[model samples]
Target: MTRPDRICVGAIAGSFGVQGEVRLKSFCADPEAIADYGPLWTEDGTRSFTVKLTRASVSGGVGARLSGVATKEQADALKGVQLFADRDRLPSLPDDEFYHADLIGLTAQDTGGVTLGTVRAVHNHGAGDMLEILGPGTKSALLVPFTLAVVPTVDLAARRIVVDMPEGLE
Candidate 1:
């Protein structure tokens, strides 16, 4: 099967009051900049949405109205829908920075050239991005910190990552 069509940029977290506005949880580094990407598509490519940021709240995320949504009920109905932008429209990263998508399939290896696994996913839990590596023939995935000490080299062109795993971490 073809790979999932979209990378999640945001999520609809229910409606924002009685208006058409919906609570948007953006996964972008700068949450408000999600609107700059223009129309976003669904995972299945069935629906497209244009986001208009209205306000931000303390507990909830930014308030936004989708293009075709007209009421709070409509907004509420779309809760949990993941939004995505075209990969090409995303801004280029600096030398030391890398987009999560670019690292997904790259091979993971130790500094000594021993194979570890392939990157199964990239996740950031408040502190920093962690590489979830799924080793060959192994069902369990290992979460490795994506810091300089652990991941010394990231050769995007070569599609490989040379890691100096933490002491006693195999």
Candidate 2:
């Protein structure tokens, strides 16, 4: 996928200290891998930034200094700026491994080929990842575990996900 289709890997949460380090929140499974991708760009494909991890912070995110940001004010101005990397630079996934971007637009279908919804987001809270699938008529989003029992097949090429929805989920 091109940069436009690239997945969001991290975000600038503003400066950590008064010196120059900026607070960065990584969306990657391996948080430190955010720096491995180098030269992250903005959603508009206009601004690009290079991150240098300075230190680990007590808070969940890391402390980093952007290439062009030398002052605290400069870092503060970039608060809430999301960063994206070229999809090609990212490592290929194993049989079960998946990129969040690949699952975002996939159509969720039941075993009988009934359409459940499209995957709107993927989230994990120390536990396994959850597929946030949005049902066709339902206003509330459904959270399905990203496991073989729940999500049996994830065919990215076909742009669809075969999910074995639990008892009442269907």
Candidate 3:
């Protein structure tokens, strides 16, 4: 389960160099801003680190130095570790925008008010974002494009979304 108080911002790709620098893959809209948020914490909230960006990494991520990580082995050991920041430290979105975490667990309904499923996850693969919905008896998940026309309503307060499922998607 994800913590409501924190939001994932980035992950450690691996060690960047022999000097203990790490390759950081940022999930933020403004990648460099990932380090602007105060101290970043591990998913479990056990480890915290202050980030100092060194340069753009060859792996398409940023080269950074994390607090307490001073050895190549130490940086390598943290590979794939997801980093999160306190939600309050992040900027608020516009009315039409949302954090991916906010969409998970929201009930999904059809345009006619029929219950479709629950949002299990949101994915973005170069093109755009897609919502993954899993219904009561479905083995395979329903993949719905998360465009303004398709996902017409996202009522966070009501914890639900209204979708206009495209033809043949049912």
Candidate 4:
């Protein structure tokens, strides 16, 4: 589907100020490139907006103006909205680098070939990336760092990942 070719480039945290600007949290490698990806689409692709970086917010995120958003209320309404860019417009990565979308749904296993679970999501809360694995018979998810020593092999062709979990981390 067309969705597969779109990558989540950033997200709207909420309105920036009394004006129509928005608080944007960019997930791009360059951060500023979020505004250069042309028109970004909402998760469902039902809505689209062109982004213009206004200024940097106090939280280290950038304030942006979205096309057609002309009031604080309009910007506030877009809180938590994910902004996606066309994959083709974005720069290609090196062999080792991967977009989060490509890693999602990949099967994860332990060093002893124990099935960990499927990768439900990849999160980066200012620290390094973490893989949220949803294992069988588990109400809660497991969080594993996405470091090379922990996750040794990532075979996208095989749709599988091999992780060397540390002690007490099953």
In candidate 2, stretches whose alpha carbon ends up further than 4 angstroms from where it belongs are 1-4
Cα misplacement distance, residue 74 of candidate 4 (Å):
1.1
Candidate 1, residue 95: lDDT: 85
Candidate with better lDDT, 2 vs 4: 4
Estimate, for each residue in 46-163, the C-alpha lDDT of model 1 and write its tens digit: 8889888898652457888899999988998999888888877778778888877778899999989999999989989789999999999999998999998899899988999998
Compared with the true structure, all predictions reach lDDT values of 0.85, 0.85, 0.93, 0.90
After best superposition, candidate 4 residue 111: deviation in angstroms? Answer: 2.8
Give the Å shift of residue 51 in candidate 1.
1.0
lDDT of 4 by residue, 13-49 (tens): 8897888999888888777889999799999999999
TM of each candidate vs. truth: 0.90, 0.90, 0.97, 0.90
Task: List residue ranges in candidate 1 displaced over 4 A.
Answer: 1-7
Output the number of the TM-score-best candidate: 3
The regions of model 3 sitting more than 4 angstroms off are none
TM-score, cand. 2 vs. native: 0.90
Ten contiguous residues with the weakest lDDT in model 1: 1-10
Candidate order by decreasing lDDT: 3, 4, 2, 1
